[model samples]
Target chain A: MSPAEHLADAGLVQLLTPAGERVDHPVYSPLAAHLDGDALRAMYRDMVLVRRFDNEATSLQRQGELGLWAQSLGQEGAQVGSGHALAPQDYVFPSYREHGVAQTRGVDLANLLRLFRGIDHGGWDPTAHNFHLYTLVIGSHTLHATGYAMGVQRDGLVGTGDPTRDTAVVTYFGDGATSQGDVNEALVFAAVNNAPLVLFCQNNQWAISEPTTRQARVPLADRGLGFGVPSVRVDGNDVIASYAVTAEALERARSGGGPTFIEAFTYRMGAHTTSDDPTRYRSAAEDEYWRQRDPIDRLRLHLEQTDELPAAFATDLEAEAVALGERIRSTVRSWGPPTPASMFDHVYASPNSVVDSERAWFESYESTFAPTQGGAR
Target chain B: MTTERITFAKAINSGLRRALEQDPKVLLMGEDIGALGGVFRVTDGLHKDFGPDRVVDTPLAESGIVGTAIGLALRGYRPVCEIQFDGFIFPAFDQITTQLAKMHYRSQGRLTLPVVIRVPFGGGIGAIEHHSESPEALFAHTPGLRVVSPSNPADAYAMIQQAIASPDPVLFFEPKVRYWDKADVDLETPAEPPHTDAAPTGLDRARVLREGTDVTLIAYGPSVAPALKAAATAAAEGTSVEVIDLRTISPLDTDTLVASVRKTGRCVVAHEAPVLYGTGAEIAARVTERCFFHLQAPVLRVGGFHVPYPVAKIEQDYLPNLDRILEAIDRTLTF
Candidate 1:
């Protein structure tokens, strides 16, 4: 019916209300209680810094530095919360806009800019951080995550009782992806195989110009039941609830409890990407409504009222954010286009005569051109 | 050397069994592959021997089969997936071309997906639509994949193991019509895995099945036998013919084809797919380019009609047969 009505649904799990008050749930509160003052401060800092990084990238896109950029402006809580809940053994397959999750995975934020700048399809070593390269194709990586979970099962790494040896997988997508065949197929595979996976969906309420209602008649979380997967809906703007639900899901997965579908109810506070203009399709009133429930602002309010926000901590975070922006601006400017011949590299792992001959011919053909002042043309 | 006469399907089964035995990470995934042993029984005994884990009977979704195989490959497993028929592969085309083919290139050499997609391809099965069709040209045109097909039982046994051992993604197209054809397989001679630096032989080279001085005829998979038969028929009519079996599709073995064409001064290509933009056209263009100066005539092509595969009763008229191959050979000789 109404936007507020959707948020206030009884099925929504809210550990912290929008008014910055810490509420409790019978099952999830105990799961989230482990976040001490230090963990809370770390998560707050993550959201702030991620927002700063996203804003800087948007500016770069406007300045013609990046080809395109996808903003995770309102998804910091859902990303950072679930990201922080992951164990080292867990693997993550993220869609294109997961800057907060990337930060939590220790990925160098500069690597993300390489993709947007059109220098490379992916920029990080997935094995190094247990975070896969961002998949631009909608809902495609869900199957990859499901298959990886199957591999974990085949490797005898599930239900081992030893937490260090056990493994789980998490794949992130938006509500619109629930309509995709691959996503639905991933659910089927994960359920039938009883694979260790968590299908984390951020219902940001918009898939570009379309709303979630266009994608499904029922709540997105209900689709999981049809596939035999247990599911939960969380107040995605509440970081504590997101973290608690993800942690419990990961624990169940590691212990061979099969797949869990988590629908994080959130909003898109910005355009879908740099090329998109949300103003044409949505209302300013709705935008303002979501701005008041901004993930970073809500956490800031809670920390301030509790007196956990020291003056020095705020100052340091602001300085860090400024430095990160400068670094992003400079790093992106320094990267030049890759070598012309490098395009033929890595097309195949084994020897390919066709590629080899073509590369040789191309090199000789280019050599025919006279050298420019800088180098060969 | 130890030798045994077996059907083409049995050879592939033996090859798959050997690959499973050679490496612990090698597994099979497809519909009806387990318990039912696949619709064609190519994987008949594997599920019973390796159990359900190694030989998996997946859900009836083609995209899911390939997409999940990618994930399994990412986790350090070699997954050989079977697409039930030639026509059924279109459903998994996105995963094959976009994701599976480009994974290594996109990852900048950081990832290698050693997954093999086995499809029973080509016509003359006298079956329904989509069951008999040659779609190897589509995969061969893609840069990141290695496309191959086997004509006889021996090559089927050896090439399947080679495809499994390869570090790159391979599209193994099996000629379904010849699945029951019997031939002697040398069981004792283990095929050496293909090497990157060396010239390819076992899986990637073109072999001269018959030699002649007048014309060179090139064919692969199910069409190889017909080409050889056509060559024999031409020989009886006082025409010397050379036959070449192109085992690998993507690389084309230009060196071998060009050398033969240069020597013969004439060439002809034959296959089951449509002649328009088919594998035969590529072979003709490459042969012409390299052997242009030495050629006495343009390279001719013999293949299926440029239309939908005809019904089962009159399918013979639509496919390339001995008479068609002989006619094409005559045209190249006369020209």
Candidate 2:
């Protein structure tokens, strides 16, 4: 078939409008049945919670509580919608920015916070929820997903034609990551092994101000063609579409159809990080253009138009959001600086003298420097 | 029990096999380790005996190998990951330093990273430049990790097992050229596995190979064997020397080192890495503090010249040999 003949194939879906209108695409019918009122409302609830938590964490950084915070501000729909579609057994390897996905995967929000707060490497356990810890380096996690899929295949968990029992791995990366050698190598490996993996690329159009054009000559989804892995592009701002496309691709993988690449066409609506100002690298006009694609606004508008959103329900949610924000502020205030002794605890499963000596030395040194509610460093 | 003479490569290979046999959760993951056996064939025939599931032949992605091994470890599997070469280990540095090293501490005592990362390290063969670098110092410096290197077959057989049984993440550096060197190994009836509880194995400490009186020769990983040979040569020149193999670099076993340094007031440190900030620098500072009155001379470090590892042809000049070690030994005694 010709290249244009294969656009938005199977579950390559698009739904909803930039201005709160409900428009269904021909390829997106299967996904519509899955998102009834309750499910659709739940997706919105998740988006709210994820955005709230992200704002809280970023605030924590500005308030001198966290060392850094990688905000998922405008990318909430991509993370939450795709995250909701995953089964309990499916493994997710998230890039550093997927705070929404971590929340959706049932990882403790507080635990995720501790990593950025400089209190831990990764406070939460990856195996507990099948959510692999956040990988900071771009494109590296794709190889992990490939390896894990290979393991799943070895376990006879693939090609059984069992939808419930069979599992697939999904690796999350960005457009910037597409340039990494490891990501390309991962595509080649996944293709050759026919591993049950999903390569999910959230093309937020900016890798800290290096635009999408810098990452790809053709589109990133098309790059998978060389490796023979089927690829898709979704309207990332549309939560329903993002979730539906991911679900279909995941279903295909679980059914032994091998790997698929999804390029979520979206825009990063916030600064690259709290340390960065987007106004420096790009034009104000570009930001305003993408701002029209704000994911939450369209979903809210669609609910309003369809009368699925109640007048009292919206007010109640707004009140709940305020409470959550206050609660987060309180949590931040109550949280004391991490104890220096906590550093020695995790170096090994058991104890080692090296850790002990360093701990002891630091304890004495910290005691001299700072006085806390309970003790010293 | 019977002692059978074997090459260091076979001893390690069998030891790995024996460890896997003992623990069902133990797995071997690396490139070419399965079908191609290792580059040096130290893990030959392992894939056939254990099946491909237990011995995974991974793609050439180092960070992913190390990072995912952390996940596997969290899932109750003991993953013995191999970074094919010392120089190639840079790709995995972020995962090793940020994730693997810190995972245990981050878990707040709730998790155990029983992951062992193996690297065939140090120089000898006239291979390309990347193949002949010693980068163990970087790993040793990282917190929440254990680092160990073995020079001889017995230590290789013993230490590798110890590292695997360790609860914390352990960076086990295998001397590549020493893989072919021979030693007597006890392949007899199995003994109970040594120390499996979550007790911190004072895992990093220097092992004194030969005791001498005049000056101390310190080395680790690949340099230990050459240091031992230098010790023997130093004996011929009437300068009695003690050869101490720093089996573990990160947790510089201060007690053993201080005791050894006190015995031999003159000290000469030898290693493949450059002298500055190498494992030797940490030793020299601590030893100087503890054995200030006992020292007869300032600690002398005989190591690779302060430059990138030289081209293969001229590496002999860059590498420290017995003659250079003897020169350091003579200089230390002169003070």
Candidate 3:
């Protein structure tokens, strides 16, 4: 069997099928049973908006407004599912491609574009929203998330049976990150410390060009078992299953059951970034296969089948997406370059004589540049 | 102040104990640090006194130790990580340089990582290859990292506490061979008083260990002992050699170095690491830039050759000994 076929046969916890049918999974059904019609519609709306923002960002990169963009084209279900599963007090550590998750956490979409525009290193205060700055280095933030979970444990924020006060951490990474030493080490630490953490691996089948087979011999979820973290596999295209599985894992973590590894088995429908050409490394047939299982389409179909989709709701959501796209495009174009001296502003929290002197020298050097012909200093 | 003689290892232990007492959030983590008291015993008895929660015996992984320390620091904990040896630090180099060093700047001052990474460095105890290497220059070269080394028990006690207190990440390189070396420490008075009317001696300034007139011998960590020894021998021969112990390597004590060089009109930099692209090179360049007209001679450097720190049998030849330091002192005098 092909890798995809083998994965499909591996008892994937799927609540929603590809043909827009809401199927029942014996294990994950009770987790999402409390989600009423409105809640289900909200999840669908989140996935649609996230996909729209991702596409707009990609267009911005193409038009030279951004340096690069990593599109969440096909994995919106996985991101929105897990993102919505989080409590307000729960913290999140994300890899660079978590723009979808950013939306769910109430992070301003324009802030996500700041890094790609070269205007800032990271554009948000993680503590303000319980969302950390996007980590570019693969698999590194898992350790940070695990450490934060350990902190939560120490602070008596876990297993208190208080749903509002108890906290759990969710860290997002891709299939490639699972092979990194830091990610594996994080699993070891989380398990040993019984840290309140959910290791969410969005298995998008490719780590850039290399397939998941290149990195892991068995299923990636199984690797967590060796580290003593209980593992589960879910159909990432099925939004309902993704939500149910992640919610279950996070609930388990907050109640002091230790770390849980949720492998969201999905596929990357776009190039790794705008800089990549998927045609060179992957087959067109594979793209076609995943395109049929688009996360947004599956949710929309499910809503339509249940007669819950109002004509005005779909029309209004489309208009909202259009307005969001325009706002992002205009803001990105109007953003100005950072001052040259600002680079040295936060190298250290306390004053360092060396940094102070260097900043002075940089100011003097920049003063030598003449004003442009436009007379805009 | 009440003073007592103690080994450098014990001084570090005492400093850690004091830091744990002073701050409830200060944590110590590393392999074998709890039960073994560290391979070099610099953290000896700390686990026993502070308990396992504060003094953590982490799984045998350097990347995990440093990476998680970054997390603890993020959650308002000051974690001091012990990298068992200088050479074993490479396993966690990516986390150190990319994460720990860049987090503060990337956060735009929203976060402050007060994590201290203590590494036992330098060679001379006749050990294995990986155990006896010097990599201070690598960390000092990185912009965000603050690198400091203490030669004797007093500075080890004082600087460890200072590094912990600072709102920045500091790479504290402990001279392993000198762990057993003894010095006077003031146990009665804290290294840093909580509310001091007087200006405390900052960690970045260099200290002039021995005063002289003809030449300045600038060194840090293990190299300071050799430079001091060379100065004493040179003084016996009527050649007054000044010795300066460089406490901090990154934000180098250039003012102290340049002033001494201007007064003496000659300078020599000594270190255990390779001279090529080492800390000595930067010091020599900075000194030349500052004391161009005051110098009677070019700044000379005494250090190991450009090769891996050799085996125990040939370490004496590879390391900057008293003789090699004296030779550099004599070379400076010739000009």
Candidate 4:
């Protein structure tokens, strides 16, 4: 089939309008046609809980309960849409800012919080969730995703044309990732192998103080064209568009269409984290402009217009979100400092002598701390 | 299980071949690894056997190799990565030390970097300056890493398996000069008794090659061979010398070392790398302080001079050969 045929097969990237109207598109129709009212409502709930969790994690960081947090306040639609697009067995390799995707993959919110809270790296088992650990490196995760996709091909997990038999890999990175040498090399490795992988680039406008233009000379999707991989640009703010696009791309991958690059065009409404100040690099006016195209609001508006969700339901979700936020707070406080030896424990699968000695020294040292946590001392 | 014997390099090839056969998660990535079977023919014929899918050839980007290997590792694949040379490993050093080393810890134990970085290290290749150098100390010093050095063919065969089977990121230092040094290697017989998965060099302990009462000669990798020979020579001199091979360097096996020193009352450390700020000195200081009363004299060291390794012709002069080792042994006896 032709490249355009593949593009058309990928679906045009939407099912709902920004003003909450259900829309129709010939090309993007196939992927989202499967998402009935229940699915959209499910997507909405996933986004709300993830957002609330994101907010609480940020507060925990500020309260010194966490080391830091990479919030996904504005990129919820992109992550949730892509997260839901993946099947139970399909694997996901997420960059650090994929809280929304983790939620969609059924990762426990408390487990993810432990990472930033300095309690644990990540508590979820990849086998249980089929969602890999959060990768802190920028574009490097793509190489791994592509390599694993190559493994998928060898295992005959792709090109079987059977939905149950096929497994696709989705890796998340951002515009800043485009600059990394490993990212480009991943493209080389993936294209040469034709690994069944999807490279999802969330072009959230600014990477730290640098704009998208600084990293990419053209659109991120256009960058994939030279590698013979099919590419697309989606409305990251529109949950329906993000879902339909990712789902189509993943389907193409599973069916042996090779790798696809999706540029989720969105904006970072909040500072990079609570640590960043948007006022320094970006204009408040630009922030306001992206806020108008808010992904969650548009999805909520579509739900309200369809009467698929009631005012009472929205109120209840808001209340539920608050309670979810409270749960996150308690989880943070209850996650007391990890056992000090745990610091050196997982560094090696088996205990190496150097690490053991270090652990022993630390154990003795920590014993010196009497009643630091409670007043029982 | 049927038992088979092979050379050090062949043993590595067999280990990788089995990983590909048993688990789909095992993959090999490195330069010239696919078509050329690696610069040393260590991975020779692997590409033909497993095809290019399992054995990968990539552009010469060290940082990209390690940084991306971290990703592949994340995708539930145990990636066995090869650094072509010790000097070239520096380019990817940051990723190894910072990202791969701390990733699991930073993730708070949520990540298991079951990735193996196969590096050829140690001097005495009789080649260029960069080609001949012992850089294991650099990686051994890093936290969240297991640094291993294999002295003989059997150790090489066993250690590679252990390093790959590990859930942590391991720096497998293959003494470049000793890669071709053949020994009786039983691939079916594991490092441990009865179990096939015995760690190649075992875990974080020192092994005594020979027992003596006059003094202790402690070393590892290329230096171990000469230290053993030196101990034999010292035997003729009536100074029975005990030689200890430090398999894992970072932890230093202080318990074994202190015990040996306490018995011998004298110690002589040897290595191919420069002695200053070298593994020998670190061992010396640690042993001296920990076993001060037990020591007969300040821990005497036999190592390469404090300078960059010399040209090929003079390279042998630079490496601590048997003569230099015996000279140090004589000095310890005089002390």
The lDDT per prediction is 0.91, 0.80, 0.89, 0.79
Candidate 3 positional error at A180, Å:
1.0
Complex DockQ, candidate 3 = 0.61
Candidate 3 deviant stretches above 4 angstroms = A1-9, A373-377, B193-200
What is candidate 2's CAPRI-style docking category based on DockQ? acceptable
Clashing pairs in 4: A11-A28, A12-A27, A12-A28, A120-B108, A121-B107, A121-B108, A144-B72, B158-B200, B159-B200
Q: Pick the candidate with the highest lDDT.
A: 1
lDDT of 1: 0.91
Per-residue CA lDDT of model 3 for B22-108, tens digit only, reads 898999999999978998887788888889888999988899999889888888899999999899999899999999999989888
lDDT of 1 at A75: 94
State each candidate's chain A TM-score: 0.97, 0.90, 0.97, 0.91
Each model's backbone clash number: 0, 4, 0, 9
Q: What would you estimate as the lDDT of candidate 3? A: 0.89
Regions more than 4 Å wrong, model 2: A1-12, A19-27, A55-68, A108-112, A115-125, A154-156, A159-164, A365-377, B107-112, B189-203
DockQ of each two-chain model: 0.80, 0.43, 0.61, 0.43
Score candidate 1 by TM-score against the native: 0.98
User: For model 2, how does the per-residue alpha-carbon lDDT over A83-183 read when each residue is reduced to its tens digit?
Assistant: 98888889998888888788788886767776776756666777788887777768777776776776677667886777677898899999999999778
Give candidate 2's TM-score.
0.90
Expressed as tens digits, the lDDT of each residue in A170-279 for candidate 3 is 99999999889999999999999999999999999988999887788788899899998999999998888999999999999999999999999998899999999989
Q: Residue A136 error for model 2, in Å? A: 3.2
Give, for candidate 1 chain A, the lowest lDDT window spanning 10 residues.
A1-10
